[model samples]
Target: MNRFWPISWQRGGLSLIIAALLVFGTVRLFTNAPEVALILGEPWEDMRQRSSAKIDPAIPGSYWGRVITSDARLRLIDLQYGFVTPRARFFTVSFDDNERVSSIRMSPQIEPLLLDDTLKVVLDLQEQWRKGGWIPIRVNYDPPFADTPEWRAQLRNVNKGGTSYWQAGNKYQVMMVVNRFKDERNPTEERYLIKLQLATPWVSQ
Candidate 1:
């Protein structure tokens, strides 16, 4: 990363013009990277090379995007298919190396939602997916899968109006996770967030 910056600058008037050009070029290069659909089955290494992609060391095999940057905002489920998704802070994606499986993306809700709203939105998506030919099955989680959320992930059962979905299928494995978060300013008050993950089925990958 450091290589992207100029290491030395002579203390002269020429330095200012050179510095300006370098910075402008760098920003243009990043901004020029096109933000497109997270195609499933695309090579992970390929996406990593995109200037707009952001990779967090903590989450391997996953990236937050060229499109969903901190300043970038897009609400995709905006009644496009008769279903609207809960507003999210941002999204992260995952991919595999099959016949180009599905592009997996996870979105965390920006704010706490009433348990009722969570259920309604999740059910709406499930029904839509069902009609689209995706089957629902019990989710069998692995090590980091359970620990993906930074908040308390224990409140994931829909029965008590907690987490919404927890299964996967061919078309998409959508999970609406209800998480408990500690309010920094008000510790006594518990805040809950919805974590949505859309992925291509393992069978497809």
Candidate 2:
């Protein structure tokens, strides 16, 4: 018998070879991935539908049932702002009269982290949004952050009140606010809050 054909043509070695070829072809098909950017550039109407589907306002009770119900005090600030220390960051979820999700506020206490900690988070978020093809649009704030000396000194503007508020959003009506505050414990140190407010079309009375 020849060494190459020692296994014998009558044997099932041919079947194993065919199976290996099929597996390799299937893997190659999946390896050639499609461009996500092209696919995700959907029409505004489609994007709106997708966004609304995330938090169906038509739903009866508060969409954040379990999330807010878990903390008794969390519910106290339904329309107003409430404070809660959950996990590593402070969390606050708000709901409209219809019990729909209105906004979510989160802040990382900077006393424990480096000075540029919040700046890093904001930059990373911006990069991700840009990658997703969303651009931030400047929105007017009632008591804008432009007033603060820190802000004015850096930004060259001022407002009436001491509090500073900066807001921006994309076409999807999603707004993000970056707030700077003096650390409670360490007065000299600063802390920041990145409040992501979902500008749902539903307006509260």
Candidate 3:
């Protein structure tokens, strides 16, 4: 009878181990199973539409304007002028949805001795027509000082100036550089050297 008891105990232990292994295998098979297929073919567009539908119409314009303006502020900067040239020049351009750049103007707050400074502006606008598509716009400028390594090094050390642009499914870019002396007493020396600004636009596609 004692021998019979040991055999029964061993059989029970083996059965328990086999049962545990079966349960573990079943659980892993279910976990590794492929997910259910999506009902919507393109999930992003559906989600976008649903989100837009949920938004309150009255507040959306204001919210969108705030978001766009806040985004624009990150690229904007103040224009500064030094002596010898009592005034500084500012250039601004506007673009519409049709990708047409207009309202290009340059105004000088303080008139400099020489108006030889050149301002180059470029605009690029391209957007994805499909839903959930993103396109990026970019603006770039090259400073007059960058023409030579020595002058470029000097500008990099002393003054920090550049042009400004904006992006809204479109790009408005401007580059302005001034090469003038800061003081009238130092006519033979170069004082204020302005560099063109390069602005880049970012969009998630």
Candidate 4:
């Protein structure tokens, strides 16, 4: 038994070396592990030098721009003027990416001159136009009329007689005009113009 112990030791050492070689080869096949690559950098550099690559121009310009992988579908039309006021009544217009008129909003600036002596002209005009209830009437009153008098006289007349007589010379008929954008390709990038006009009906006292 003691003479056979050296033979057993020599066999065990050879088995250990073979097991180490198998493990190293298996790791070399499966892993892209950086530390292992560093150990074999020279061969990897030679492999990369032999490879060919080209640049693509379709890449986005900025980081934020790059993050958007899909194409843009819609854009807001820039209105040169922000908001319309009574001193500046106008129509608001917007276009889609295809350059079609997507939306149009009429904004009238009811100037003090237009409704100076009237109690309900602006409100009545909007309601009547929207509801299609009544034909608008124009009025021209003589001198000594109050500027925007209270609704007392008009309301009292309605309560008593079931009909009201608004001062003849104090009413003005208003009309609005709006211009929409024309159709074009790539509407968002193209320039557009819109115009708004307000006309008053002639009145006789």
The top-ranked prediction according to lDDT is 1
The C-alpha RMSD of each candidate to the native structure, in angstroms, is: 15.0, 24.8, 31.2, 38.3
Q: For residues 128-161, what per-residue lDDT tens digits would candidate 2 score against the true structure? A: 4455544444423323233334643432221221
Query: Which segments of model 2 are wrong by more than 4 Å?
Result: 1-88, 93-103, 108-115, 139-171, 201-205
| Model 1 per-residue lDDT tens digits across residues 86-197 | 3333444433323222343333333444444444544555675556554444433311122234212344432332333333333344545444444344455554444454
The digit string of per-residue lDDT tens for model 4 on 105-198 reads: 2222211111221223334333433343223333232121122344333322422211111221222222321112222332343211111211
Task: Give the distance in Å from residue 8's predicted Cα in candidate 4 to where it truly belongs.
Answer: 92
Q: Which ten residues in a row have the lowest lDDT in candidate 2?
A: 30-39
In model 1, the Cα lDDT at residue 28 comes to: 18
Candidate order by decreasing lDDT? 1, 2, 3, 4
* Model 1 misplaced regions, further than 4 Å: 1-39, 42-67, 70-84, 95-102, 139-171, 184-190, 203-205
Per-model TM against the reference: 0.44, 0.38, 0.22, 0.18
**Stretches > 4 Å off in candidate 3:** 1-101, 107-168, 180-189, 193-205
Pairs of residues clashing in candidate 4: 86-109, 99-187, 140-169, 141-169
Candidate 1 clashes between residue pairs 3 or more apart in a chain or in different chains: 40-101, 40-102, 40-103, 41-100, 41-101
Q: Indicate whether candidate 1 or candidate 4 has the larger TM-score.
A: 1
Which run of 10 residues does model 1 get worst, by summed lDDT? 1-10
lDDT agreement with native, every candidate: 0.36, 0.30, 0.24, 0.22
Clashing residue pairs in candidate 3 (N, C-alpha, C atoms within 3 angstroms): 87-110, 141-198, 143-196, 163-197
**Candidate 2 residue pairs in clash (backbone atoms < 3 Å):** 145-164, 145-165, 147-159
